[model samples]
Target: MLESYLQVAEVMFMQVRLKAFIIFCVYTCAKFLVKRKCEFKPFKMLCEFGWILTVLLILKITGITTGDFGTTSVFDGNVQISFNISIENFSIATLLNLILFIPFGFFSAGVLKKLRSKWIYGILIGLIFSLTVEFLQTFIGRFVELEDVLMNTMGAFIGYEIMVLVIKLKDRMKMGALKVE
Candidate 1:
């Protein structure tokens, strides 16, 4: 079972990487061409690249990319939307959902200037993204769960906190270095 999951993940990673590469190339070219007067910021570009990769990976892993919209009828009954807010639903899948959004939150917090100091914005962004995914899943014949949204939001919050911690640690290290001088 684990091997199957790994294989699927490998395939998904390849596909997302290809797509992200093309998108990034176009984005980079456009930025260079369109904003000739603006100075390039490598750090900002890196953050944007990370955000793109993270979103592409998330979309691929969520089965949103694999769905055949034209062939599968929405009423065919394969579509499952669970609004169950039960503790019993907390399982490996829930953990995976949480883990999946951590990178999203981290990148979002890094890329969006407003999200750096304000954690609420991060959580809200996570919630909105999760809700959008879940809603889109219904049309794609994937199972949509409310628990996933909750877990994903929590994961985003954790990721944001982790980024904040890292920033603080780096600042402390800089301070220490100055003191040693």
Candidate 2:
């Protein structure tokens, strides 16, 4: 029980640190962009990096591309045998994929140009990105599922919608503040 508690604490700490780092990066980038009179879109390299990191972390957590040969057997040290897939496994994989792509969608929306249809653009990009990842996984001796693409796209769409909502809320607050002044 104590060990579990420690693990939970460590996880929480890591999450907080991750959030802080992301916030810091955004703040610095915003400052730079504003000072330079550049478009303050979030389409910087850091946002792209965040998307890539999300993909890698998802793959790592799924344990498919980790080169973990314990459950794998390389026949004659040349070919890797395939693993079985079940409905439950597919469901879990789908859920994880969806969760993994949410950040990408959210960040992409922020980085995209100011347009009411940016969320649609984000969804399309997310779908393409997910397809590319799935294709790459196939070449890497990892199992690729069509369901994962659907789930990831759905996740990205939902995330983009949330971002849109947040932006609207922020605009409203700003307008309200201006009225007060």
Candidate 3:
């Protein structure tokens, strides 16, 4: 038992292939460019993907999503993996995936603000980005789970709301005081 665990740990920490790292780099950078309208720094997304990819690499190294990557399942013989979290394994990776995409929605709202003021637009933006990621993952041999899409979009919506509320609060505070005589 201990030997199996040790083997998994050793496998998981091995240097991630340059090809995989580059793939993540290109993908994350492309998303950064798409959200460029707001003129905000892309620094946040750098950190976001840095952490996200790190988690993914770690999972891959450890073989957590082993035995065939897809949205399928069977109790015996066949093994399956879900991109989303399960009731039993409420782990850090699940939280990180949800947390990492918040900036995508928040800054995306900044981009959308130039066109229109709509929270639904933010939601749409989140869903689109997440769907793109999820679908891309399917090609990359990761499970594409709808449950992950829902949680990721929900996170985006929350991020968008926070940004909107902050702007509103700032406006209100400014309007309430310090009039020029």
Candidate 1's C-alpha runs over 4 A off are 37-43, 70-79, 174-181
Off by over 4 Å in 2: 1-90, 114-118
TM-score (C-alpha) between model 3 and the true structure: 0.51
- Give the Cα lDDT of each candidate: 0.81, 0.63, 0.59
Query: What does the lDDT come to for candidate 3?
Result: 0.59
TM-score of each: 0.82, 0.59, 0.51
Write one digit per residue (lDDT tens) for candidate 3, span 95-129: 65566567556655544554128768767877886
Error of 2 at 17 (Å): 9.0
As for TM-score, the candidate ahead, 1 or 2, is 1
RMSD of each: 2.9, 6.9, 8.6
Residues 70-141 of candidate 2: C-alpha lDDT, one tens digit per residue: 423233343333434356665544565677678778766766645237456767977987777665555445
Better of 1 and 3 by TM-score: 1
Worst 10 residues of 2 by lDDT: 71-80
**Over the stretch 28-91, how does candidate 1's per-residue lDDT look in tens digits?**
8887789776557775677678889889988888877776554364567676777798787667
Better structure of 1 and 2 per lDDT? 1
* Top-scoring candidate (TM-score): 1
